[model samples]
Target: MDNSLRALGDRLRQLRARHGLTQEEFAQIAGIGYKFYQDIEGGRKKEIWLSTVERLAAAYGLRAWQLLMPNMPEGSKVARKVASSRVHRR
Candidate 1:
């Protein structure tokens, strides 16, 4: 698996635990299939779709970029770059 995907899985697992939710519960909340959610958390799914990212973010009450780049602070260089690119696309 890619290192980035592994990190994302780790972060997602941490978030799920922090929220006191089981994988099944998290999957249900995210409106994703339980087995697919497990694959993501286990880093078996390397390439996540943008819609899935959005879903995960909504499930955690976070922005899509937050899930894409875990631990990135708001107003940081990377965040600004992503935001600007998103704006340019619109």
Candidate 2:
């Protein structure tokens, strides 16, 4: 992992744009604070909670790793493991 929250946030914003969801709408669906998402998008946070990631995954119809590694295609090892881990609630 690059551990670059800003890059991850940028990817998130890009993905949200691709899905045509506004920040408010995506935050509502993802169970996150609009400002928090904005902060994340703004690169203000270096660490993001797992709960937020899980919420985002569920709401975005993706596994945690899909969002975590959003540029990769679906079913990649990271996404698969993330999905599998989520299935087991690990």
Model 2's alpha-carbon lDDT is 0.62
The deviation in Å at residue 81 for candidate 2 is 24
lDDT tens digits, residues 4-84, model 2? 676677777777777787877776666566777787767877676787677666666667777777374353221211222
- Candidate 1 off by > 4 Å: 70-90
Candidate 2 colliding pairs: none
Compared with the true structure, model 2 gives a TM-score of 0.69
Candidate 1 local lDDT, 21-50, one digit each (tens): 888777777777778889989999868777
For all candidates in order, the CA lDDT equals 0.68, 0.62
* Model 1 local distance difference test score: 0.68
**What TM-score would you give candidate 1 relative to the actual structure?**
0.74
The best candidate in terms of TM-score: 1
